[model samples]
Target: MSSPSREAILASASRLFGDRGYRSVTVRDIASDAGVSAALVMKLFGSKEKLFAAAQPDERLLGELNVPREEIGAALAFRVLMRREREMQEPWAMLPFTVQDSPDPEATRAEAREKYLGHIAALIGDTTPNRRHAAVVVSLMIGFGEAVRTLGLFDDWDFDEVVAHYGALVQAQIDACPVA
Candidate 1:
């Protein structure tokens, strides 16, 4: 049989982590599922912690932020709102605890959080002025998304409606800020 490539191993790991929760899954589980040796998994990713980080979908959040500088707030809010909806519909939405339980959990979360804040800071042209406010806005969006998912509101509400509503609120907050 042909050996699985590193990409294939990572792909299996991503799905497994997304489906089973990171802590619940093991190297053997990923290895067996990927049709690769556990040693290969370790060799490629260093350790399970590293593997989980590598497999996280945080990049999807970053990817969605590739918008015009002038529209960063609206763009970021829209992207996060959209991601929240997508995550809710996917099995992985129920598995954030997996990422939260990582060895460097704070660092992992900070990295993801920074991605959002950095975009806003760049758009506003000042990391110091209203940075806390920007952080709060992003936090609200994330918290609301989690709440919606936890409450299973997506079953009745369309994802786009959620994004648009939240996006408009975020835009209003941005507009309310004193001209920088």
Candidate 2:
């Protein structure tokens, strides 16, 4: 099993990179947050760049699409919200900040657009490829995540209540989409 220090370094890297993006954070920053020395971080991960890559967020936000088409939005909402609690990072929720601060802004933006927004568009059945509705849904997703995780908007609220209400809102946006 990996040592607790290794896991701490990984979690610190994930949070710092997700919150501040790749360019803004340094090895010392991650090591400091993890309560370790920079040397140990380098020993474990090799380099800051490598550590960032290792800490990249999973693409599981839109994963596990076994639900009915009509219920996809709620499924997505539930997954993202739950992940915000269980996982250290929320790539979709943190995309804007990451993109804005990225050293290679164009590449970062393009990759995210293709992977996330494109997949979301497809999930919403925009086969005609139009994505206006899906974009709005993404906005709501980011907003909901920020409100809950960063701003603590739902900290005192019931988890089910927050997810259910937010899920329904996401579903409403999906339902508003023009059928392909």
Scored against the true structure, residue 173 in model 2 reaches a CA lDDT of: 84
Candidate 2: clashing pairs of residues: none
Provide the overall lDDT of each model, using Cα atoms, as 2-decimal numbers: 0.63, 0.79
Q: Give the count of colliding residue pairs in each prediction.
A: 0, 0
Which model scores highest in lDDT? 2
Model 2, which residues run further than 4 Å from truth?
1-6, 43-47, 128-130
Who wins the TM-score comparison?
Answer: 2
Across residues 119-159, which tens digit of lDDT does each residue of candidate 2 receive?
77878876544588888888888787777667878878877
RMSD of 2: 2.5
Report residue 180 deviation for candidate 2 (angstroms): 2.6
Q: For candidate 2, give the lDDT of residue 175.
A: 89
